[model samples]
Target: MHDFPDIDYTQRFIFDESDVRGELVALERSYAEVLAKHPYPEPVAQLLGEMLAAAALLVGTLKFDGLLVLQARSLGPVSLLMVECSSEREIRGIARYDESLITPDATLQELMPDGDLTMTIDPRQGKRYQGIVGLDGVDLSACLSSYFVMSEQLPTRFWIKADGKRARGLLLQQLPAARLTDPEEREASWQHVNTLVDTLTAEELLSLNNETVLHRLFHEDAVRMFDIQPLVFRCSCSRERSANALVSLGLEDAQQLVIEHNGTVEIDCQFCNQRYLFDATDVAQLFAGGGVDTPSDTRH
Candidate 1:
């Protein structure tokens, strides 16, 4: 195992002479925090970590105020894998898998047979946009590459790696006609950068710092690096949000649940495993359109 620094951030870089941009993300504490909430299998954890890194990388490329979610759904052992990265760089992820069906060495195709990847961009003040692509590629990185090629009509490539403890990703994309306008030059530049990036191994991608990795890969190219943006593991679930969920159940149904559970109704957040208990009085107050005080016990 590599002794990585206590860092979790994403940095953007652009080629000075070419019309290409890129982002590199390295996640350690945020990845560990998400895994601590659930006892995921090794393969499941690795895939989830990769998804977390992928979400962060994609969100860095966009200019939205809401969130970017990367989700995969299938009918195999791993039923669902979802990761969300807010515009503020807070991330949370969860995985659903059947223990009995999971093998020690299950490939992505075996674990997620018939799966499809969905990229959703939800802005704070506009309509949400979503793009779906079939899981035709062997791994998450390849699937994402196909998404950009088909949906966005941009030439994009990704190098993603995860080992249950840390996750890192590198993305190279060709922007619209800018510094390099000639079509032939654009193609040549894209190919040249991608060809060099192809030499990057999973070990190097997961272990090296952004500067070292960039230098090792593109030392001769004129690259402009940007400031790093911090990322953290933060579940969106809160006591207020849980209370709103009880309200959505309606007073009658909410009261019945409280009665069936011996004067208390417990709501557990799947992503963070935090419990929210509403007793008879709390339920009544919620129904009365009054504020409900905090629960007696809360788990972090």
Candidate 2:
């Protein structure tokens, strides 16, 4: 195995003579940081890790300039699992679940039954796009694969795995009218690549580096690996954004909240546990269009 940096990153690669392109994502610190935010059950943590990895892999295949959000809402034990990845490779995620309802060995389908996965692309310069699919598949990867096939009309496959500590994913997508033009040739190439990828095991996917994984799967093929783009666990919540949220609630309601909370209304970011406080004076200044002093204890 080649020596590769064991860090959170997504690497893009393409088959030299085929119309298939791929992305490999491995998450360690980012995954750990997300898990640390809340005391999630093992099944929920593992599923959240896989969703985080899936978000990173999907973001690499897009040409957008903003945020990509992967959210799953269900009526099962886990109510919500949300993961966000920006164009800059900054990532953060959170999960909401009923601890008593979640069993130790529950599967994704059992935990998130009657759910839907929503993918939203909020671009900075253009209109936002969103696609939703029923979580009818057995896992996240299968649902997302069906999403691509139904919404994008593209042949896409995902192999994602996550333990409590680490998460990794591989995505293979067939580009349109690229190197392989003939329909039969395209189908054959797609099947060929996916067949090789099917052999990847969960342990190998979670433990191996990007290069070694690619080589092990596509050693006989011509694959061009690109530079790895680093990923980090970053919460986009800030004092200003939190203030803006407070301002959105009219002055009367904001002041009432302050009174209700004993002169301070606090906004706690669920993703990172960062607290933003607005006192009576701060709320008045915010309504008066005056700047408020930044808080010193913003870290988790």
lDDT of 2 by residue, 1-300 (tens): 435576789999999999999999989899999999998899999999999999999999999999999999999999999999999999999999999999998899999999999999999999999999999998889999999988966788999999989898999999888788999998998999999999999988987787789899999999999999999999999888888998999999999999999977889999999888888878888888886664434522
Q: What is the TM-score of candidate 1?
A: 0.96
- Model 2: weakest 10-residue lDDT segment is 291-300
Q: Return the TM-score for each candidate structure.
A: 0.96, 0.96
Residue runs of model 2 more than 4 Å from their true location after superposition: 1-6, 294-300
- What is the C-alpha local distance difference test score of candidate 1? 0.91
TM-score of 2: 0.96
Model 1: lDDT of residue 202 = 96
Candidate 1 residue-wise lDDT, 40-159, digit = tens = 999999999999999999989898899898999999999999999999999999999998999988889989998999999999989999999987689999999999989866788999
The count of backbone overlaps in candidate 2 is: 0
lDDT of 1 at 216: 99
Superposed on all Cα atoms, model 2 deviates from the true structure by an RMSD in Å of 1.9
